[model samples]
Target: MKAAIVPALNSPWEIREVPTPEPSANQVLIKIGASGLCYTDVHITKGAIPTQFPRTLGHEPVGEIVEVGVGVTSRKVGDRVGVPWVQSGCRRCEWCLRGKKMFCQQQIGTGVQTQGSHAEYMLAYADSTMLLPDSISYEQAAPVFCAGYTVWSGLRFADPKPHEKVAILGIGGLGHLAVQYSKAAGFETIAITHSKNKEKLVRDLGADEVVADAEALQKMGGADVILVTGNSYKSASAALKGLRSDGRMVLMGISEEPLEVTGDIITNRSRIIGSMQNGDEYLYEALDYVAKGKVKVISETYSLNDISRVYDRVANGEVRFRAVITDM
Candidate 1:
């Protein structure tokens, strides 16, 4: 089997023939149909995520089950599934017992801790794999595993009521899908971005209005819930003023700088929170929305052979939104 391996930090991705892995107890083997390339892969390559060398750094994959382990009863061969960020969590952990699997300290990250789905075949725990709806194609289902799941889970956790304004920061990957989800969930959707070029695109994605910056968002009665999807700490911090009194702000992207918690943030009783990918339940919800046409995942498709080139595009922000490696 040919796979892209990161031999070292800050090194180029190498596609080499490696032995394909077989499914273990409670695991299933998947023939990958499409894999989503995320910016976090760049972080891993730069040694920011602290993964071991010679790793395959892709987690968002949609594929078909080629074989199922003897202990796996929930899934069978010939089933279509999606492998998400959280591969598996220790079932005995308190967080996992409470249904908050992402918070489990013993969680296993698909690409970060173990071999990931960047090749023709990858291993996924049967319990962690999401059964993809037939209506959702592999290309569309791929990004929902990570980018879509993150934003959708964040928005749900924010818990905005009907008619409450929800502002999605950034117009790329996650933000684009957040706009659609926010609208479908009955929130008065707003798109906040520094780029004026995305105004039209965001509006077309179901946003009720587009604001150039956080200040403009404040002028529109402020957002009841602000979902931060941009990677810039400065931009996210400045957007604090856009939150309405007692509103909540969810950070879904990683930022280098700390968010300034000024007196104003405290006086307004605004809440700042961070959310990661949830359990299989959230993944199913993300896919359900996509299957029903409530959300549209915009992505550029690349062949598995061009994994390195696609990584370069993602790192340089050249891809319009999410990039998926298909044709495996």
Candidate 2:
């Protein structure tokens, strides 16, 4: 099987012929149909995510099951499934018991801790795979495993009211989907972006309005729920000023800079919460929207042999939204 591998830290991606892995007990072998390349792939190459050398870098993947292992009666061969980042964990662990499996000490990350799906075949725990909706294509449903799941889970965790106005603090991969999800779920959506180039694009994605910054958002009327999906803590902090009193703000991005908590957080009792893809139920809801055509995932497709080109465009911030390798 030909797999894309990062030989070492900061090394170029090479398509190498490697032995295909067989599924162990309670696992299944997936013949990857589409694998979505995330920006985190760049971090993995630079050793930021801290994985072993010669790793195949991709987590957002969907494919068909070719074989199932012992104790995997729930799924069978010839079934379609999407493999998520959190493959599985020690169920007896504290985090796993609490349903926050990603934090489990022995948690397996699909691309980071195990062999990823950027190849002809990869192994996945049968319990961890999502049954892809027949209505959604492999390319469209792939990003839902990561980008869509992250944003939708964040939005739902924030718990916006029926009449609440939702604002997205970025308009890139995650934020664009956040905007659509906000609108699809009946919230009046606003896109807060620093990129002048994305204003029109975001509006076309169903954002009720586009604000340049927190101040601009403030002038347009403060939002009841703000979803911070950009990778800038400074931007997230700045957006806090536009949060309505007693509003909720969900943090979904990662940044090195510390977020500044303003006085309004205490005086107005505004809530700030951090979230990742919360649960398998949330993952299904995220996919349901795309399956029903309530959300459109913008992506550029590449052949499996051209996986290196996907990395170059993503690193340069040239992908329109998500990039999927489909010709595997």
Candidate 3:
């Protein structure tokens, strides 16, 4: 099997032939149909998210099951499935016992700590794998595994009231989906960005309004819930000024720099919260929204052989929204 391997930190990615892996008792082997090249993969390549050398880096994978282990009764060969970040966790931990496995201290991250779907075949813990809906294509459903689920989970964390103003920061991969979800959730959806070019695109995605900057947001009386999807700390900090009193700011992007929070951010008892990859229940809900066309993934597709070029495009933020590597 051929896989894209991170030979070492800061080194160029290499496409190498490797031995196939057999699934363990509680795992399933999948023939990957498509994999989402996310910003998180770039972080792994640059060592920002530390991991062992010679690792395979791709967490959002939609594939067909080729083999299942003895203990896997919920899944079988030929099952269509999608794998996310939470590959496996210590079932004995308090968080895992309470059904919040993502918070387990001994969580194993797909692509980060384990062999991921950057390869033609990979092992997915049967319990963590999500059954993909037939109505959604593999390329489109791939991003929902991570980007879609992240924003959906973040919105749930915000818990906005009916008809409250909901603003989406940034207009990239996650931001685009956030716009649609916020609109569907019955909020007066707003897409906030510095780019004038993205206004029409955001509006087309069902945003009730588009604001150019934080100042514009303030003039509109601020948002009740702001979903931060851009990785820029400066932009996120500026966005805090546009949150209404008692509003919530949900951070969904992974940034290297610290967010400068001022006393004003808390004057109204506003909350600054963050969300990680959610459980299977939320992932299914995210997929259902996509399957029903309520939420869509704007994406570009590439062959696995051209993963290096695709990686460069993702790292440089060149992909319009999401980038999926398929034809594997």
lDDT per residue for candidate 1 within 1-328, as digits (tens), equals: 9888989889999898999888889999999999999999999999888888889989998899999887999999999998888877788988889987778888899998888878889988998888899899999999999999999999988888877899998888889999999998888998988788888888889999998888898987999999999798788889998999999999999978978878988799999989887556777888999999999999999988999899999999999899999887
Local distance difference test, per candidate?
0.89, 0.91, 0.89
lDDT of 3 by residue, 36-59 (tens): 999998888887888999899899
Count of clashes in candidate 3: 0
Measured by lDDT, the strongest candidate is 2
- Local accuracy of candidate 2 as per-residue lDDT tens digits, 136-189: 999999999999999999999998988889999988899889999999999999
Structural RMSD, model 3: 1.1
Estimated TM-score for each candidate: 0.97, 0.97, 0.97
Q: Which ten residues in a row have the lowest lDDT in candidate 3?
A: 274-283
- Give candidate 1 regions above 4 Å deviation: none
lDDT of 2: 0.91
Error of 1 at 243 (Å): 1.0
